[model samples]
Target: MRIGVLALQGAVTEHIASIEKTGAQGLPIKRVEELDGVDGLIIPGGESTTIGKLMRKYGFIEAIRAFADQGKPIFGTCAGMIVLAKRIAGDEAGHLELMDITVARNAFGRQRESFECDLEIKGIADPVRAVFIRAPLIEEVGPDIEVLTLYKDEIVTARQGHLLACSFHPELTDDYRLHQYFADMVEDSMTANL
Candidate 1:
């Protein structure tokens, strides 16, 4: 299986390392053309507004939206989650607008930047470890969205069909189950298309 990490910004290398641990070839997607070579794509943690501007500047907005329309799975972590959401809490315009959810940027507040916890994701058993650093929170989810893991009654991880998102930095931790989960989604999408 092959997976691509959005290389426009964020923890590109770290995500690649974690993806490789899942026995999948991880590629860095710098250009829109690079999207064709991967079965699934990951948008890692980074500043949301900057990532949005860069994506627009590089022509990834339409390219990635097309990629998702092909039924290919897209996983967004942290600010990446913000990128996918259809709504942002403030007046900030949404980017990609792929997932039917609303997100609050920097929802964790300034005091708890390095908060860690074990979360019980919907699919994965035995609670997965999650790290929150300037993470966004899923304020509300539409009917299409499936709530995965919640932190203190707030939505942190949720999946909608082929698109998956997490408010915290799942790539920062050693856990690869979330990556595996996304990989499986990609693999499944490939098979169903056949």
Candidate 2:
């Protein structure tokens, strides 16, 4: 299946590499029309505000929302997670609110505070090494959301319906399990359609 990665900014190349590793066709989506044929989308880690602005400027906000509304799988990481959150507690400038969670931006402080840690993700058998760079913290997940991974007592990864969000960057690591998981979801979706 073809998977599109939001190429507005941030770790786009890494995510593209991960998608390719998963044996899925990787498409860098900059314009709205590029999203048309993808089976799933990945909103990679980046500056949320800038990405949001670019998304709006390029008319991708509505297109992405419409895609998610159609039950297509979406995996958002870091700032992407912020954009997907339903509410951003500390954000003065509004970001795209897509998921049913409340997030606090830069909860881990500045770039110096950025660190890596082992995460016990719900479905993964081994501890996943998560990379957090100026990451946000998920403060509250709505009843519909399922918490997936945590770090130092804070929620960092969660899934609700077809939307999966994480404050850490799994694409930075060599592990492709998470990407494979999302790919599995995409496969399931395609099979269901058939």
Candidate 3:
């Protein structure tokens, strides 16, 4: 399956590498046309506002929304979590409003406060080592969304319909479970369509 990584900014190469390592085609999506052939998409960690601006500037915001509306799976991480939230509490910039949840950007404080911790993900058997780098926290998840992982008494990962969001940087870690989970989701969707 082909997956597109939003190449607007931030950790694009790392995400590409991770996706490739998962045995999927990793397409660096810079333009709207690139969205046509991908089965799934990844919005990597970066400055949310800047990425939002670039998304709009490059016409990727609407393109991505259109793809999501078509039932394509999307996995967003870190600042990407902010981009996918329905509402953003602490930030003035807001988000893409894809998932029905509220997020607080940089809720864990500054870069100096960034840390790593073992996360108890709901489905995964082993603890996932999650890296939080100025991450966003899920302040509220809508009734339909499923909470996947939590760290230090806060919600760090969740899924709603075809949209999956993570507050920490999974790409920064060696763990491929999250990516595998997303890939499995994509595979399920593909099989269901058949």
CA displacement after TM-score superposition, residue 49 of candidate 3 (Å): 0.4
Roughly what TM-score does model 2 have, to 2 decimal places? 0.96
Ranking of all predicted structures according to TM-score, beginning with the best and ending with the worst: 1, 3, 2
Q: Residue 38 of candidate 1: its Cα lDDT?
A: 94
Write down the lDDT that model 3 would get: 0.88
Model 2: per-residue Cα lDDT at residue 80: 91
After superposing all C-alphas onto the true structure, candidate 2 shows an RMSD in angstroms of 1.2
lDDT of 2 by residue, 63-174 (tens): 9999988788999999999888889896565565779899999999999999998889998899888899999999998899999987889999899978999998989999
lDDT of 3 by residue, 1-194 (tens): 99889998888888878788889888899889989989999999999999999988988878889998888999999999889988889656565789988999899999999999888887788999889999889999899999998777789999997899999998897887888888878888788778
Q: C-alpha displacement of 62 in model 1, angstroms?
A: 0.1
Q: Residue 186 of model 1: what lDDT?
A: 90
lDDT of 2 at 100: 89
Write out the backbone clash pairs for model 2: none
The top-ranked prediction according to TM-score is 1
TM per prediction: 0.97, 0.96, 0.96
